[model samples]
Target: MKELHIVCKVRKKRYRYISQISNKITPNLLKRDFKKDDPNIAWVTDVSEFRFNRKRLYLSVIQDLYNG
Candidate 1:
């Protein structure tokens, strides 16, 4: 192996400024209303996972709020 000489350069420090705004509150539209009057109006979907024999299984379901 042969010896080598290396040169290093220094960089100036940089700073960043961030501005923040106040948060506003929003109202809820559903308000725990799960019932629907007409069909195909509203539908809810959920995903569930289970473990079986060292393997993972996922089940996805979508039900109509009016009928179900």
Candidate 2:
């Protein structure tokens, strides 16, 4: 690409507003115990973000520890 004089453009990160920024840490309640005797007694969820083709994609999931 250097021979072709191609250049890639990257966006600069913008400053976040006060409401969007967080300084507190959340406590974990599950303590890494994934096994449960019954459904709905304990639930787990996760969220992930990916960047592809210059676009952002988010995946969110929730599952019961008993059956999952």
Candidate 3:
């Protein structure tokens, strides 16, 4: 669905925008670099789907770079 694509882009781009400007939003914003040395600095994760018993199972993660 279109909404799914829009949301997926939003989720991925949220971290990108936040990394550059702290508590600020801009129309012409540049993408943020994914390089940090803090535990919560790099919170990267992914999601996937698998069929189980004819039903869909989704998986997601919110990882910490320090612990991982």
Which has the greatest TM-score? 2
Cα lDDT tens digits for candidate 1, 8-49:
669786766546644767777657889989988878889998
lDDT of each: 0.82, 0.90, 0.66
Best by lDDT: 2
| Candidate 2, superposed: residue stretches over 4 Å from native | 15-27, 49-58
| TM-scores for every candidate against the unseen true structure | 0.52, 0.58, 0.43
**Could you list the CA RMSD of all candidates, in the order they appear?**
15.4, 3.6, 13.8
Decreasing TM-score order of the candidates: 2, 1, 3
Model 2 TM: 0.58
Better of 2 and 3 by TM-score: 2
Give me the displacement of residue 68 in model 3, in angstroms.
Answer: 0.9
Can you tell me which runs of candidate 1 are displaced by over 4 Å? Answer: 1-29
lDDT by residue (1-68, candidate 3, tens digit) is 78676544443433344566577656632145555566665677899988899999999977765666
How many residue pairs clash per model?
Answer: 0, 0, 0
